[model samples]
Target: MDNFLEIETSVKRVFNSFRHEVDGILDRKLTGGEFRVLSLISSGVNRTTDLSKKLDVSASHITAITDSLVANNFITRHRSEVDRRIVVLELTEEAKEFVASIEQKKKEMIVRRFSVFTEEEREQFQELLKKLAEN
Candidate 1:
């Protein structure tokens, strides 16, 4: 029990630290929720229902976040061809480019944060994380 608690604390600390670093880079332009929505849209997650279920967020929350995304021209919604009642969300060209830029920045930020670890150590860390995930 003590070990599990320690692991949980460690995980929370690391996750929060990384999030703070990313927030610093984003300059308060994007909240984590907005970033998540953008990433999902960019990765081909198109339906509001699908995103809500996949992210385990409330429908209202998803709607609120998507509204901001739409306002910023990061995403647009259209009626589905097969199901007129269903709406499909897609990234605009500008949004696509923005997503790419943010992704690159995120990668660089992570690399910079982890650069103190030797390559072998980083690989080992990844393997351990994978193993933990599998369990």
Candidate 2:
């Protein structure tokens, strides 16, 4: 409604800056897509097909991302006990710790960034963001 491109760019910058900041803190790099996949897996979307569906990506695309995660020792893939055809993905212990650390850092960063706003303002901002995100 108001310079849509500007709003889009600003949103992109916010996420990219957070990722960059986290990358610096961790002394490593991860693509936004990779981090998202890790987050989803951590949150209980374990099946490969399910992840593809949730992310709206193709199965092969998910596999490529998971393959890198596996190679990095961040995740492990196994066949479902009940259904060997389905591939289950789990974060390695190291990945759990890594994700926890990243979450903590992100929480602190967001808190600091939003500190300038009053509590009511923060709540309104959150609600507005959610409204914008609604389908």
Top-lDDT structure, candidate number: 1
Candidate 1 all-Cα RMSD: 1.9
lDDT, candidate 2, 1-135, per-residue tens: 979999899999988887777667566656667877998999999988899999999999999999999999989999989988888999999999988887788789889878999999999999998998994
Q: What does candidate 2 score in Cα RMSD to the true structure? A: 2.2
The runs of at least 3 residues in candidate 2 whose Cα sits more than 4 Å from the true structure, single-residue gaps closed, are 1-16
Candidate 1 C-alpha lDDT tens digits along 5-105: 89889999999999898887667877888888889988888888889998998989999999998998888999999989999999989878877888899
TM-scores for all candidates: the values are 0.87, 0.84
- Of the candidates shown, which would achieve the greatest TM-score relative to the real structure? 1
Global lDDT of model 2 = 0.88
Candidate 1 regions off by >4 Å? Answer: 1-9
Distance from true position, residue 85, model 1, in Å?
1.7
Candidate 2 local lDDT, residue 80? 88
